[model samples]
Target: MFNLYFISQSTCSILLLLNFALKNVACNPVVRTKSGCLKGSIDRNIDGGKFYQFMGIPYAEPPVGDLRFKAPKPKHPWKGIRNATEEGSACPHRREKRFNQSVPLVGDEDCLFLNVYTAELPRNSATMKLKPVLVYIHGGGYVFGNGGRAKYGPKNLMTEDIVLVTLNYRLGILGYLSFSDPTLEIPGNAGLKDQRLALRWVQDNIRRFGGDPNRVTIDGESAGGSSVHFHVISPSCRGLFHGAIIQSGSTLNSWPWGKLDGAISVVNKIGVKAKTQKEALDVLKSLSAYELVRVLEQMGITECSNDWQDISPVIEYPHEGAFLTKSPIDILNAGEQNQVPLILGYNSKEGHWMNYQQMAAKAMGTWVAPFSWECIIPWQTGIKKGTAKSKRFADTLERTYQTETPEENVVNAWSDSIYDVGIEQAIKFHLKTHLAPIYAYRISVITRLNYLKRSLNLWDKPGVFHSDELGYLFSQSITPKVSPGSPEDIYRRRIVKLWTNFVKYKNPTPDDELNVLWQPVESVDPIKQLDIGENLTFVDTPEARRFVVWNELLEESPFIIN
Candidate 1:
């Protein structure tokens, strides 16, 4: 009453402070990671509840300049809050077939990023339980996949009491090039190292996002699935994840490991001195990231080898950072790896996805695309295309698995070689070595929306092509232009329920939701394989006959199948 103006100023100051306090309260979901404080946006669930969404969070420093082709370094800590709202750039890769070759491509070199999705929290609730975590590594044959794609939204997945995490690592040349030097200089599998670092990041900071670090599960499909297999054996990933879900990719697959010469040849074609590794390294270091990728593209050789290999993970040279010094099959056969719960399985028609016409073209001496099978080694092994040795291998393939037609034979060869046989070997080895709960399933569900039905010829009358389960799993993996709640949608829900139940509870069979029981893989049980479809039908291992031929070949050969 004595000083009205002073009273008004004091009131304004109080209002200002109240506004600031409210702002801080509104940002209650902010997470304090080891790197820095992150301010993520919130999204409304289908149930009209809000959940924290942290996107484009840097897990490792950008693999640029000196960091390129080297193991990933942890990201430095920041002083202030980082806005993690947008998705990160995908690692550099060759865009699939295009009409215009002249146009500049997409992707970036600074792509070591991860995203986290936490379930909706109640207002001012401290009793909320930490959720189980699933960190997924995207697969594109170690060449062309990004974790931030629109199709992989965590909306449906997050509905369960699970924290979903997805991440990107280096790909193709920047990821898989092996200098093959003993000094650990350019030790191959940098991409895999990137994945390791991302896992470390999750282990370090997932708790801040209300995730139980101890209950982390690593999962992937195709190349991503192989990555999961590698983690199972990698010492660096020992305590990072508890359970692994390998879908449609066996590390023992004919793919994944790049031939030593093939990686060198890729570097040589980039206008580098082919005389020595040092010279090649010098030239590679001097070129810009985009320039290097462009040169690789113009050369018309996909990655290091053909699509089957294409410069993926390789046994690292014996050194400090060596993740794998010998073949994974040898180590697993000897029972040397981190013992953990595992769910290993493959799609119904994992091999029918590859084009028979394209393979026939390459075998018939036509260069259809950059990654044709011509550059392959063991099928020829620098012995020239028409040599007797090459012919013998091809002839052996025909005799190994007799099919209706040559085209069918080619598709079947790819199917068995790339996925079925390899998976069988891994399963057989797992049975021999580890006694932990190892469950294997044959995903024989015939979906209404078969991805490969229209794309590739169905000479084999395959029930489901590779990655058809992805549509039922991830909302965005495939789009059939059909609305949800179809037969496929119901199956998708069933698949998700089973998968998430495994994550929440170790055994997928014990869940009370469905009366189905997915038993652990066994030698005596003929109907151990879980056939996931409209109804749960227990069937014998579907790929038994194919494995018989493959087991014999794998046992005799010292070198891995090429």
Candidate 2:
């Protein structure tokens, strides 16, 4: 009897393996990208359907050595088969601290790679019915993030029947910092240029991977959202993609506008003197990529610093087929953008993270005291400019940060001035300019079991913090604390349905079978917030009180125009 049972179990196991293999086509090969023929795989998941996967396809030539700061050019065609089975290396490191331990890994300079995933499994000689493509740009405030970051893997979206693409762009000094020395002509925003090149690559060759070239939807969170905002009006990016989804980011946020001057300042601080423009460019091109990264990292301003006026894409004259608007607001006002369907919104607890950090610093008694009492060199340096603007900003902050105490007030003020005001300005401007259908929402899920399980939180602070909503869309990049299984999981399913429907039909509202008809966002009406709490409801006007406060502040301040 034992022998018979063993034989029967072996037979059953073989049959099961056969069934699984038949149901899923793993790593199928295709011949249609700019980089020659490549292979991909397919699999099924609990939430999504069959998914076709392509990993580490070269989107641009490796930006290494002298090519480091220049806008990425097209990758040269290869002769032999290129291995794309594994994810390509990530760009140089930026800090990501969790629970007081550093997470370090190997990264490379030649990291301009992308991954593609699709729901359709195209058989030989059988055409795949074109599906809407949703290209996601990951957020790390434009300084530190990788498309390879596990939390943002495209598996879930692929199963939802949307073609998904994620690519790595230049970051930190390599991507953003410009050497002002007259010798350097390549100047600023190599990173932003890298993103443009990737989109161009997609426009040129996504159809072969079962994606509709014409139905591409670009989306991002945080800095990624900022990039989407930049691309909207870029002349070089015209007709490259259709539709955009901006989350938790907007135009009114502090951006690095003066590319050439900003680059000069950064390079000068790093001890590079430019006698002439060409000499400056030659010196910059000579520095090793790793040496530059190491030097910038030691400056203490490397990671966790998004200098409002020193670290972003700037308006540049069109050259080599690359062009971008001066600012997002300018594009909206002119209506010169792609004018594709858009879904723009932000989280309800957007500013809580920064507010909490300030509070924590105060509790530890390590808070750097205000500058009014001190003007010594300890707080002032030639590289750092302390102007009337800084003084005014400090005085205003000191006044508005009022809470139970001085410490409490500082935290409140930071949150209000930064995240709150910034997001409000962009949304209001978008509403004022364009007439296309727009959908907006406020994410308000705090401490749900399922969501927390799949996120990366720094301090256990509650509420949907920045990029916290990302996990609801993919299984990658899960926080160690959040466990699976809860009512919170349902939110992800609902969101994927909404987003895919939007990409497919240019509307976030679902059909009869999907059972939800999300109304379009209105300028006067209160937001139909997606409260991810237990037994969620559509509030008449979510955060009505806060909106009034922000709007009132905007009217008083010259910076924000309602």
Candidate 3:
């Protein structure tokens, strides 16, 4: 009898071990997409709220070989359940350098992937209410960055009832190389096309992941922010998203908007004797993806240069699949844009990042060059360099922002020239025919979560640097962990709430549970904005005097306003 009881106990233990192993192997959630079934994983937010993550889902086919420099093709359907627990490779781009060190290239050419995060998964689609979607496009000056969770994690955002998505698009030469000849089939703005395709993918498949397609809000920072504005103006992107949140970027930003002689420059740099556009195209296509990106690095192209020439978005010649065919200013002036609810703004000191290296050099007592007035001249004014108009504008800028030091002058001057003027201009043009409310803001809150500023050793410096507000919205890996009920945590929570509220209700202060009645810009004469600082104060005509000078200067310039 004792032997029989021992044998029964052993048998039960073996069965229990086998059951545990099976559960571990097959417990992941699987969602059926139009392309195929995607197996995602579950994660818990900082607040211990459970959320579902679907990572590295291919939205477009690999733009390789013949598909290079062309619009992304839709990803073909796949068989069986695809493992989406891991992130796909980022698009081909050089790794961000630190301390002026040369970084190796990272990512793959076949990197058209996107990640989706949702707080809840629908058990029964017929009875479940879908959540609002927030599609984020990352910014790297149209050259670097990815939609990976390491940089743009959904930990804080997942605590709210929303579906978050981040996507990877083509970058640099591979994405924006355009030939003058339309017949060459290389119209620029392929990167923008990649983004548009991802949005379409969201519309068609987001519902399956418990997302509401009709209530999608597109958000981006820097180049990605400008991308959001581009979509807002593009006729093809109408109805894809209901609202836009543009942070530190705009279509009117002179740096990344206009076409440059990129194709000719590439041909000359690569030593290709291409006499015709087709020959240049052939030579470009023959080069490997790594070779193409290596060339861009060799060109010494860093983000936020005073020089406007770069491989960025351009007005493409009219073609069947051209992403942008006209100037964004013209499009806005004609009221041909998608007129969605917009929340556009910049940091209190947008130029801090641009002047960081110089500031550091000064602090270290290193040899720093004298400030050049030419750098501060607004490139959008179209005044020729060294011309009488250019000198007059530069002189005016020097007098206007009369700071104690040249570095301070640079910070203020670049802030207006590079970021503020363009964004304000976009708002002005958008308001001319805007039927929807425009919520403008200036992020001035400073906290421990200011990762970008801290990383550059500028945390102790005055003024909130560009992209400081991003730390409050999304939990990045570099940022220190926020303690519950801490000041940083409270600020982060408030920012997230405001953004998510805009995503849901199109009004940031839907009910003002946060006790801040954020108002929208009612007129361009004196643009009102929410100053997100220690206190959410409503400021009217904050930049009126500054912009008046800009307006007068632009009016005197030769560039005709449509």
Q: What Cα-based lDDT does every candidate model obtain? A: 0.68, 0.60, 0.80
> Which prediction has the highest lDDT against the true structure?
3
Per-residue lDDT of 106-167 in model 1, one digit per residue for the tens?
A: 68899999999887432222455778889988877776768874646676676678888999
Tens-place lDDT per residue, model 3, 1-562, is 2321223434433533443355444356667788877767888887987788999999999998778888999999876557789999998877644213246778899999999999766655568899999999998878788999877999888888999999999998888888768667788888999999999999999988889999999999988999999999988898999999999999887667545346666676666676776776677777788787876655553223235564778888787877787777788778899978999999888888767745554564544443566665655666666787677777887788875476766787778877888898888888988888999998888999875786666766777788888788887878797888999999889899999999989999999698988888888777888888887887653355688887887677622321
**Alpha-carbon deviation at 245 in model 1, angstroms:** 0.7
Model 1 TM-score on a 0 to 1 scale: 0.83
Q: Which stretches of candidate 1 lie over 4 Å from their true place?
A: 1-28, 44-49, 96-104, 121-128, 182-184, 260-263, 270-272, 298-310, 356-396, 399-406, 448-462, 477-485, 524-528, 540-542, 558-562
Winner by TM-score between candidate 3 and candidate 1: 3
User: Clashing pairs in model 1?
Assistant: 151-476, 377-381
lDDT of 1 at 38: 62
Give Cα distance to truth, residue 471, candidate 3, Å.
0.7
User: Per-candidate TM vs. native?
Assistant: 0.83, 0.79, 0.91
Clashes of 2: 23
Better of 1 and 2 by lDDT: 1
